[model samples]
Target: MRFDILTVLPGLLESPFAHSILHRAQKKGLTEIHVHNLRDYSSNKHKSVDDYPYGGGSGMVMMIEPFAVCIEKLKAEREYDEIIFMTPDGVTLNQGLANQLSSVKNIMILCGHYKGIDQRVRDLYVTREMSIGDYVLSGGELPAAILVDAIVRLIPGVLSDETSALSDSFQDDMLDAPVYTRPADWKGHKVPDILLSGNTPEIEKWRFEQAMERTKARRPDLLE
Candidate 1:
C-alpha cells in the first residue's frame, strides 16, 4: 500500500510514522508513506497557502490552488483509490472503515489547517471525508496519522501475526475480551482459569462469552 499525505505541518507527523509498527512496515517494504508540504505547491513567492476568508471569518482558510495543484500532480502520476479529507464533520472513522481501506492500493489524504480548507477543494478533489470523532483539532495532521496507522496495520503482510488484527476489538462488532500476560498469579489477582487451561475449544468459547459481556456493558449500540 502507498499513502501520500498533504499537509502544511508535515513536521507534526514525523514521530507517528517513524516508530513502532509503521516504521517496521516501511522497513519491510510492505507499505510506503510520503508527506508533501502544501506550501511547496503554492504559487505565492512567500509560499503562503492560506488566506483571510472572503466573508470575513475569524480565521484564515486554506486556499484551494495548492491542494488542487498537488492533487492534480499526484493524479497524473498514478490513479488513487481514495482522496480523503480529514475534517470534523466527515464520516466517523471506525474499525470497519479501516478494514475496508486496508485493501486499497493507493491513497491520498489532505490535512486541513487554520479554519479549514476552501469548500471548492472538497467538492472537486476529495473522494471521501473522514473524522476521528465528534471533536475538533488544531490541524488534520494528527488525524491523518491516526487514520493511516489504523488502516496500515490491517494490511496482510504489515503485521507479523496476521491473525492479531482479526482478533482486535470491533472486528466482529464486539469489544475484545481482557487479556493477560505472564505471572498467572499477580499478587492476589489471578488469570482466568479458562485461559490457563489446556482445553483450546473451551478457552475460545470463554473468550467469546467475555467479549459479548464486555460489548454489552460498554458499546451496546454496536450490537444493533
Candidate 2:
C-alpha cells in the first residue's frame, strides 16, 4: 500500500510515520508513506496556501490552486484508489473501513487547515471523505495520522502475529475479551481458571461470552 499525504504543516505529520508499527511497515516494504508540502505547489510569491474567505468568515480558507495542482500531479503519476479529505463532517471512520482500505494499492489524503479547504477543491478531486469522530480539531493532520495507523496495521505482515489484528475490538463488532499476563495470580487477583486448564475450546467459548457481556454493558450500539 502507498499513501500520499498533502498538508500545509507537514511537520505535524513527521513523528507519526517515523515510529512503531508504521515505521516497521515501511521498513519491511509492506507500505510506503509520502508527505507532500502543499506550499511547494503554490504559485504565490510568498508561497502562501491560504487566504481570507470570500464571505468574510472568521477563519481563512485554504486556496484551491495549490491543492488542485498537487492532486493532479499525483494522479498523473499513477491512479489512486481513493482521494480522501479529512474533515469534521465526513463519514465517521470505523474498523471495517480500515480493513477495506488496507487492501487498496494507492491513496491520497488531504489535510485541511485554517478554517478548511475550498469546497470546489473537494468536489473536483476528493473521492471519499472521513472523520475520526463528530468533534472538531485544529487541523486534519492528527486525523490523517490516525487513519494511516489504523489502515497500515491491518496490512499483511505488518504485525508480528498477523492473527492479532483479526481479533481486535471492532473486527467482529464486539469488544475484545479480557486478557491476563504473567504473574496470573497477583496479590489477591487471579487469572480465570479456564484459561489455565489447557482447554482451547472451552477458553474460546468463555472469551466470546465475556466479550458479549462487556459490549452489552459498555457499547450496546455495536451489538445492534
Candidate 3:
C-alpha cells in the first residue's frame, strides 16, 4: 500500500511512521508513506496555505488552491482508491473501515489544520472523510497517523504473525478474550485453568465465550 499525506505541518507526522510496525512495514517494502508539505504547492509569495475565512471566522481556513494543485498532480501520476480528508465531522473510523482500506493499492490523506480546509476542496476531490472520534484536535496529523497505522498493520507481512491482526479486538465484532503471560500464577492471580490445560479445542471454546461475554457487557452495540 502507498499513502500520500498532504499536510501543512508534515513535521508532526514524522515520529509516528518513523518507528515501530509502520517503520518495519516500510523497510520490508510492504507499504510506502510519503508526506507532502502543502505549502510547497502554494503560489503565494509567503508560501502560505491558509487564510481567514471569507465570512470572517475566528480561525484560519486552509486554502483550496494548494490542496487542489497537490491532489490533481498526484492523480495524474497514479489512480488512488481513496482520497480521504481527516476532519472532526467525518464518518467515525472503525476496524472494518481499516480492514477495507488495507486492500487499497493507493491512498491520499489530506490533513486539515487551523480551522479546516475549504469545503470546495472536499466536495471536488475527497472520496472519503474519516474522524477518529467525537473530540476535535488542533490538526488532523494525529488522526492521519492513526489511520495509517490501522491500515498498514493489516497489510500482509506487516506483522510477524499474520493471523495476529485477524484476532485483534473488533475483528469479529467482539473484543479479544483475556490473555496471560509467563508466571501464570503471579501473586494470587492464576491464569485460567482452561488455558493452562493442553486442550486446544476447549480453550478455543472458552476464549470465544469470554469474548462474547465481555462484548455483551462493554459494547453490546457491536453484537447488534
Per-candidate RMSD, Å: 0.8, 0.9, 1.0
Model 1 lDDT tens row, 160-181: 9999999999999999999999
Predictions in order: lDDT? 0.95, 0.96, 0.96
Report the C-alpha lDDT of model 3 over 1-224, residue by residue, as the tens digit.
89999999999999999999999999999999999999999999999999999978599999999999999999999999999999999999999999999999999999999888999999999999999999999999999999999999999999999999999999999999999898989898899899999899999999999999999999999999
List runs of model 3 lying over 4 Å from the truth: none
Q: Model 2 over residues 72-153: C-alpha lDDT tens digits?
A: 9999999999999999999999999999999999999999998899999999999999999999999999999999999999
Residue 147, model 1, lDDT:
99
| Clash totals, every prediction | 0, 0, 0
In model 2, the runs with Cα more than 4 Å from the true position are: none
lDDT against true structure, model 3: 0.96
lDDT of 1 at 49: 98
TM-score (C-alpha, index-matched) for candidate 1: 0.98
Q: Estimate each model's TM-score.
A: 0.98, 0.98, 0.97
